[model samples]
Target: MLELDLTARLGNFALEAKFSCETTGIVALFGRSGAGKTSVVNMLAGLTRPHRGRIAVNGTVLFDSARGIDLPPERRRLGYVFQEGRLFPHMSVRRNLSYGYTRIPAAERSIGFEHVTDLLGLADLLGRRPGDLSGGEKQRVALGRALLANPRLLLMDEPLAALDQPRKEEVLPFIERLRDTLALPIVYVSHSMAEIVRLADTLVLLSEGRVEAVGTIEDLTSRLDLRPLTGRYEAGAVIRAEVVGQDEAFGLTELRFAGGGLWVPRVEAPIGTELRIRVRARDVALARERPRGVSILNMVPCRVEDIGAEAGPQVDLRLNAGGAALWARITRRSLAKLQIVPGARVYALIKAVAIDRTSLGRGAGRFLAGPAEGNLEE
Candidate 1:
């Protein structure tokens, strides 16, 4: 368990946060730029001292102002990956990785050098220096170095912010593997909705040095209050599904969710893969019935769970598809015309182009096979 109740004053700005969680998985501290995310992380890392409150990780007291039990960053056994790769430019990748291992006594080293290298796909670039690597490669090396230290907790502050779209894609899978395969707990800070949707198991939302909301992705997305902070276009629900099959002829892949099968653009994944799909509220349309002879390929029958009012002529609808949930944003006029209400059964009409490709991850096929079999049932 990780618990924190900290307060800090930086000139005119003040940061106060109090939150706790049970799992050791990735906990994303999410918010826009200058929202006190970095401030909180720095305090937890012992880089900055908080004026009051305590911080404990798995019963270990890292900071306690009242008790005066603050520990230095080095002794805290925490690994930090910054926005830019801070590797030694003069050293080779192998040398940089070895530097961490050399610090730990051989008997105390829990993670091996070769293991870190293989996990981050750094085996091929061991001879290369930081200067010779791309943005993604350098970040991978930095991650490898951090893991090799076998820290109790990891801190990532917008690790992908410095990279372009393609470069970000290159490093995401490795981070996923680390989260799923390794036992290390991660505190990842990011402002990108895509990163939070794809990577976070738990979310800690902050606004101007204060904790706004903290919970699972589903819980946070469903809250009407958090919607305004997420921005209009980025508001949506994340659904888990499996890949059942593919249609090579039409270049379409079949994904099975709780409510039914969703045929999106062709996915480059194997059969029986698990996937996390983000269906934006703006991209979903509510239909009164299962309309036929339409170009829209994805439609799922759902029950209206809740409705939320938005600024400037729109309302958001929360729909339950089988056991999973989806969000739909429609104009006030359209909602009134359709007479959509809570408990109303309707089909969510989704256009093919609305599905964003970059949000799809490596395990897109996993979700298609597991739940797809029963999702087609009426």
Candidate 2:
């Protein structure tokens, strides 16, 4: 487990956060710019000292101000991947990765050069210098360099923040592999909701130098306070589903969620692929019955679980579709006119255009293939 209870003052900003997690996968620090994410990371890396409190990772104490015990950044055994690749412009990618490995005593190195290369898909680019590599390639090299150090924990501060959409996409799968394949824990910092939903297994929400909330992505996303942070365009619940099959003639892929099967835009994934999908709240429409003439391809029978207060002009409705949870943001008048209430059986209508194609992943496909069981309450 990773734990932190620290306070620090920087110019006009003050950070006082206390949270702990047993996350073995990626733990994301999410918030807007100037939300103390960088500061917290710096403290964890021992680059900055907190005025008070303790920091520990798996029973090893990194800092304890009361006892005046603090380890230096290099001694913290953390692998940090910064926004910039920070690769040696004159050195080949191979050399950069080897440089860190060489610093450690040969007997102490847990990860070997070949293992790093294969894990990062860097075999083809080893001979290339940073100048000759694309942004994604350079970042991979940077990640490889960190991995060779055999860090107990990995700290990535918006490593994809500087990249274009394509570059970000290129690096994401590698990051996912890092989480799934390795035992090392990760503290990833990002303001993007899409990244959090796609990558994080646990979340620590920070705002203006303070922690707002910390929990699983589903738990935090369902909270009203966090809705505004996600922005209306991206506000939604992430669902894990399975790929049952493909409809070749219609150019569509069929996904099975809690209540029923959903046909979405064609996705280039194999059968039995597991995927993650984000269904935006605004894209969901509630129906009292199965409509006959609607063009929507995805409609699942669900019951209203609860309703959140009207924020701005819309009210957020939490619905339980079989065992999976789905959220919809509708006008207050609509909720009243439709007489929507808890336990009311309804159909969740989702347009194909509203589903984010990029957020779809293999993990979701596997979930859809399995029989729906247990409640996935948000």
Candidate 3:
């Protein structure tokens, strides 16, 4: 487990972040700029000291003002991947990775050079210098170097921020592989909702210099109270789905969840691959009855769980589809006309195209085929 209840002062800004989460997968520190995302990670890294409170990971106390225990950065044995790849200019890719691996004693080393290079897909780039590598390649090398250190925790400070869209995509799959293959805990820092949705298992929302909420990405993203920070335009529900089958004829892949099956654009993964997807609230519309003879592919029955406070022209909605939560953003006029309220049963109309490929993500681990459900529309 990772825990922190620290207070620090930096000039005019005062931060009092207090939250604890599991170390199973990626725990993202998410917020806008100047929201202390970096500050919280810095303190955990021992680069910045907290004035009061304690910090611990997996029961090991990293810092404690009361006990006067503050471990140095190196002594903490944590791996950190910075925003920019800080590779040695003169060193080749092989040596750059070895620089950290060689420092750790053979007995303490949990990961080997060969394992890291292969896992990161850096075997072919071993002879290239830092200057010759692309943005994604450089970052992959950085990840390898850090892993060789055998860190108890991995801290990534927007590792993909410097790369463009294509470059980011190039490196995202490798990171997913790393998370699934390794057992190490990670604290990822980023302001991008897309990145967070694609990776994080738990989320720590920071606002200004404080933590607004801490929970699973699925729970927090569906919350109406956190819409202002989650971005009204991007606000929606996240669902865990399994690839049931592919319709090569229509260039679509069907995914089955607890609620029902949703057909999305063709996904290359084979049957049974579990993927997480976001359905934007704006893309969802409410209907009194299931409409037919229409182009919309998904029309699932749902019960209204809650409604949000009116905001000018639009208001957010919380829906329960089977056991899963689905959110929708509808205009106030529609709410008045439709008479949608808590416990009201309605149909949630979702367009197949609204769930884009960019938001699709594979859950960490081996992809297993799920039990065959009867109908694709069910």
Candidate 4:
């Protein structure tokens, strides 16, 4: 487990960051630019020392102002992957990876070169130089080099931010493989909600150098108050569902959550596969009752759990359909005209196309459990 409660003054900006993450997969530091995400990671890396508070990983104190204990960068045993892959231009991929692997004593190195090569799919690029590799390939080589170092904790600062969309997509699978297979604790930093939802297990939302909120990806994305931080355009609910059925002729797969069965673009998983889907509030429309002749393929009965504060022209109504949480964003005029109130039954309308295929994720091991019935109001 990683425990960090730090206070650092950087020029005119003061950073008071604190959050604890389980020693598991990815714990993402998510926020806008200049939110002090990098400063927090730097403190953990021993690059930037906090003026106050403490930092520890699995009970080992990395820093403590009260106790006057602070470890230097080289002694921290933490691997850092910066925004760009800082590989030696002169070295081959094999030589670059070997640079880190050779530094640690033979007994201290648990992750071997063969495992890193196979896990990162770096077997083919072993002889290639950094100049010949793509942006994604270079990052993979960087990751391999870091893992071979066998650091206690891995710190990644916007690793995917430097890559284009296609390159980002290419590198994502390899990161997912690392999250699933490696036992190392990873602290990932990103501004993209899509990346956070896909890879992060715990989310530390930072705003203006302070920790705004800390929760799981599902909890934070579903929060109405954090909408401004989650980005209005990207705000939505993340629902965990299981693949129940498929329509091969139509190229669609049916995923059942507590809310209902949604028909999405066909997934290659088996029937019992548990997956996570993002339901953007923008795509949801509310009706007092289910439409009779509507062309929309997906509609579920939901009740307003709560109404969020009015932000500009729109208002968010948090809804619960068959025990699953969903959100709908509509104008203030529509909310008033519909007389929508808490506990009121309404039909949540959604279009399958609006469900972002790129944002779909694989849940961690276990499936979600709740009232599986699709029609809560029926």
Candidate 5:
């Protein structure tokens, strides 16, 4: 487990962050600018000092003001990847990567240079200088250099913030690969919801230098009260589903969740492969009764759990589909016309095309061709 409770004063901004999460998968610090996301990571990296608090990772204490204990950045046993690569322009990629590896005593080294190079796809770029590498490639080299440090935890402060869309996509899979293949824990910092939804296993939501909430991505994103912070335009619900069947004729794949089933565009994964899907509220249409002969391919029975206060002409609804949480956004006119209220049964209509291919993520587990297992609510 990673635990942190810190309070700091940075110029005019005051930061009070406190949270803990398992040291498995990714824990994302998500918020807007000046939310203290970077400040929290800086404290974790020993780059900044907190007024009072303690920080411990997997039972190892990194800081304790009361105890008067603090470890320097080098002794913290943590790897940091900044937004920029910050590679040595004068040296070849191989030598740059070896810099950290060679600094560690052989007895303390747990990660090998060759393994990191291969894992990050840096083997081919070893001979090239940092000036000759693409943005994504340069970041990959930075990742390699960090891993070679054999740290217990990894801290990434918007590692993709400097990259373009294409470069971001290029590096994302490699990060996912790193998470799955290695036992290392990661603390990822980002403001991008797409990045948070795609990569985070646990989420820490910060607003104005404070932790607003801490939970899984689905729990935090589907919340009605958090709409203002989560962004109304990009707000949606996330659900975990498994491939149950395939429609060869229509080039579609069937996914089954605890709540219901959805037929989406063809998923390349084999049957029983678990998937994480994000259903945007704007893409969902609700009806008082199930519609027939509609162009919409996905419809699930849901009950209105709660209706958010009217925000101008639009209102958000929290729905319960089976045991899973779902969200919908509709105009007040539609809400009044349909008379949607808590406990009212409704059919949620979703267009297959509305599901973005990029939002589909591969879950860590694949089942044995039976009933869908795993908690969608989790």
Candidate 6:
């Protein structure tokens, strides 16, 4: 396990962060700018020291204030990939990657040159310099260099923050490959919910230099109290589903989820492929009955779990559908008119087009990672 209980003061900002996650897949440190995500990353990298607390990976102590155990950056055996690749501008990509490998002794090197290069798809770009590589390619090289070092834990502080959407897409699969195929643990830092949904197995939500909440994507996204912190514009529930069928004539695919099936803008993945879908609370319209002649193609039966305190014109309703949580936002007038109440069963009508391309992602396991409030992030 990767454990941390950190405290530090950088200038006027005070940071106190404490969280532990499995030493596998990706654990994302998520929040807005200046939330101390980078500071936490730096502490893990041994670039900065916390005034108090302890840090360990897989039971190996890297830092302990009480014990006076502090390791230097190099001895920490942690790889740091900054926003920029920070590659040696003068060297070729091959040499840049080799620089990292050269730092470790041969007896301790578990990863080799060919493996890192091939894993990142940098085989053909060996001769090119960082100046010639694209934004995404450079990030891959940074990752390759880190992997070649055979670090015990990898720290990425918004590596994709410097890339455009297309570039992010280019590097995402490679990161996924590392997370799924490799045994090493990764600590990914980002504010983007899209990246978190696609990459994180466990999410550590930070706000104002403190650990606000920590849990899986399914768990954190469902909390009504955390709506504002989760970002009002992009707040919603993330549902896990599997590809059950497709309709070639309409260019749509059927995803079998916990409650029912969803027909989305045809995903290219084959049948039996699991998917993670974002259902915006605003996009969902609750119906008293299974309304006929409606254009909405997706309707799942749900029970009202909680009604968030409505200080505004609209109220947010948390629903439980086939054990998965969902949210629906509607005005007070509609709520009373529909006579909706907690424990009342209702049909959640959703338009497929309402789910944007950015909202769709991949689902791991049986879609249940001990569901909580991150997307509740769900």
Against the unseen true structure, what C-alpha lDDT does each candidate score? 0.84, 0.82, 0.87, 0.85, 0.85, 0.85
Greater-lDDT candidate between 3 and 5: 3
Best model number under lDDT: 3
Best by TM-score: 5
Residues 169-241, candidate 2: write the lDDT tens digits.
7888778766666788999999888887777778898887888888987778766667766565677877777
Candidate 5 TM-score, C-alpha based? 0.93
Candidate 4 local lDDT, 1-378, one digit each (tens): 889898988767889988887877789999998999988998999997788989999999999999999999887889888889999999999999998789989999899998788777788899999999999999999988888889999999999999999998778877777776678899999999888887888889999899999887888888878888999887788888889998999988888999887888777667988887888888899999888898777898899999988658898889998978898988889999999999999999988878765667755222211111221222
Please identify model 6 stretches exceeding 4 Å from their true place. 268-270, 363-378
Quick one: ranking by TM-score, best first?
5, 4, 3, 6, 1, 2
- How many clashes in each structure? 14, 19, 0, 0, 0, 22
Global lDDT for candidate 5? 0.85
Alpha-carbon error at 144 in model 1, in Å? 1.0
Taking the tens digit of each residue's C-alpha lDDT, what string does model 6 give over 150-217? Answer: 99999999999999988987887778767766788899999998788877878889988898988878
**After superposition, candidate 1 runs with Cα above 4 Å error:** 266-273, 341-343, 361-378
Error of 4 at 225 (Å): 1.9
User: TM-score for every candidate vs. truth?
Assistant: 0.89, 0.87, 0.91, 0.92, 0.93, 0.90
Each prediction's RMSD over C-alphas, in Å, is 5.7, 6.0, 5.4, 6.6, 5.2, 5.8
Error of 2 at 144 (Å): 1.0
Cα deviation of 138 in candidate 2 (Å)?
1.8
The number of residue pairs in model 2 that clash at the backbone is 19
In terms of lDDT, model 6 sits at 0.85
In model 5, where is the ten-residue run with the lowest total lDDT? 366-375
What's the residue-level lDDT of 277 in candidate 1? 79
